[model samples]
Target: MEAGNATSAAVLQARELVKRFGGREALRGIDFEAAAGELVAVIGPNGAGKTTLLSILAGISRPDGGEVHVPQGEVGWVPQQAALYRRLTVEENLMLFARLEKHEDPRASTEQMLELTGLTERRGEIVARLSGGNQQRINIAIGLLARPSVLLLDEPSVGLDPRQRARLWEFVSALASEGGTTVIFSTHDIQEAERYGGRLLVLADGEALFDGSADGLREAVRREAPEAADQDFETAFVAFLHHRGH
Candidate 1:
């Protein structure tokens, strides 16, 4: 309850998280944590409940069982897509969301966000006109307008090019460095996780398979299954699944 020391206090924590859809269990039980200024990535294969876990943390959906504790002003969410109005300009969309949230300085924040997202030149362009990568950038900027201490990003690099993805991660790292924002993002791209995430959580069947540094995961794979050492993330992930089953 007492968030430990100011430096080490966890911005987000979930224990034994579970979710069900119809008769099937989407999440068995998941435990995750994000400390201040940490950039953690959630990696897993399809149907592994990565998105489901992120949704619960983002407050977009509730978990069937388990506890999620986040302090006020300590959370923000960037969904997979832009979620912007197709007819509205980028600036208009930001203004609309800010006003809906009843933020004190919607206009100023909107302006700042436009600058931050590199959308100043295209602020008046309809969201539908922007490229996919730019739209995603706007989505990230909108999420940050509230200046949350923790940020949850779900598959942010899905439609981005290599350059755009690199730029986005750079921005995220800068945010973490400057504001000490704890970021937890779900990624299918293992290379992206290796390059950007300070810590990695590999999930399988809704359970944490690995929770530690990327280097630690590599070492574990090497120790447990040497054959997977040369394989890429997807292959290694599959190997992990097979090894866990046997």
Candidate 2:
């Protein structure tokens, strides 16, 4: 697919983002964009800068170079960690975050989030008492408390059971499709990325190798490694990377 242009109507954009740690570069001039209601998956191996990229987009870390354009107070981020008040009750945690966001009605926002994340029944339970999956749900609920236009998830399915993962995807999918929210998720799971992303961004060694639909990725693999045409996606992807001298 074509790279995002300067004049594109994208809600979230990064222009030549660069990040470095000591002698190692975590990102090398990455350009990315996501429009409203789009599901974009970022797939890469460990230490390929997926986390660094997401952190930059979420404003958790400043990029060494480049600019990010996103509306102020319009972006929400759910990192791999459950950044919740473990001692607080589920409802209390949501209320606190909603108040921090300065929502016009923190009570209403908390109520909505409780229902949205299916945590109403567990609202009174202390956060530390919740299961891993439930804790993840609460974290995502907190992120959505203000109804952000852009949501960034970094390895969201980590430590989640299959059922929990399914539930999370269903909710996120609806948020992008029905709620008209832009969702960017990072993952190392090939199947998860291919299954969910309307578009995929493939990264390796801090470089963007490909960006497009799953079919486009397959076609790219077919062109780069003809023998991989009949292979599984993981095998074909490796072959494609080999051909690219990665």
Candidate 3:
């Protein structure tokens, strides 16, 4: 329960992380870490503890026993579900966070967020009035208001169509490649994870089955199942999961 050092070597990290909900253990002593400017994807099935891991790392929920190190500003988080005031305008939502975080100029910061998310034209539109994709952009903008070093997202592409999902991933890729923001996002879609994530962390039954780059993951799967080695990431990952007995 040490809040941990905000200036640690890794932007974010968890050691022997464990979390439980009554009788069931959601996370089982998983050790994880993210360095600055790295894009990591957490992949798992419905009950594989992906969201639980994200919430714990985001400091939204605590681990029953473990240590997590994060910098001063709260870790930016975009939950699977929207976390916004449906009645608030897009800019209004950003302004609320800007002021809450005590930004030097709330309006300026809010404007920057609007432009970043390509929501300037819809700044005055109520969140409930925007499409699901735009509402998600607001969720991400709010997360950026504090400029936290690490951003954690849960199923960020939940409601998007294939094209919209691709666009969102492109934006996220630029954020890491150009903006230098460390991002860790969870997704049930293995293909999406492999396509967008620079590194992959596979979790099954509350444990990390694999932690490495896409190519490394492919090699690992190939080593275990020669047939899958020659396949694409999606095929390899599915084999890897089966290898883990998920």
Top TM-score model? 2
TM-score of 2: 0.95
- In model 3, the Cα lDDT at residue 130 comes to 87
The sequence of per-residue lDDT tens digits that candidate 2 reaches over residues 1-246 is: 234223256899898999999999999999998888899999988988999999999999999999999879889999899999999999999999999999999999999999999999999999999999999999999888857899999999999999999999999999999999999999999889999988889888898888888888888889889998898998888888788777
Best candidate according to lDDT: 2
CA lDDT of every candidate:
0.82, 0.90, 0.84
Which residue ranges in model 3 land beyond 4 Å of their true spot?
1-9, 229-232
- Over the full model, what C-alpha lDDT does candidate 3 score relative to the true structure? 0.84
Better of 1 and 2 by TM-score: 2
Tell me each candidate's TM-score: 0.92, 0.95, 0.92
Where in model 1 is the C-alpha error above 4 Å? 1-7, 232-234
The alpha-carbon deviation from the true structure for residue 141 of candidate 2, after best TM-score superposition, in angstroms, is 0.8
Task: Write candidate 1's Cα lDDT for 125-156 as tens digits.
Answer: 99998888888988888788768888989999
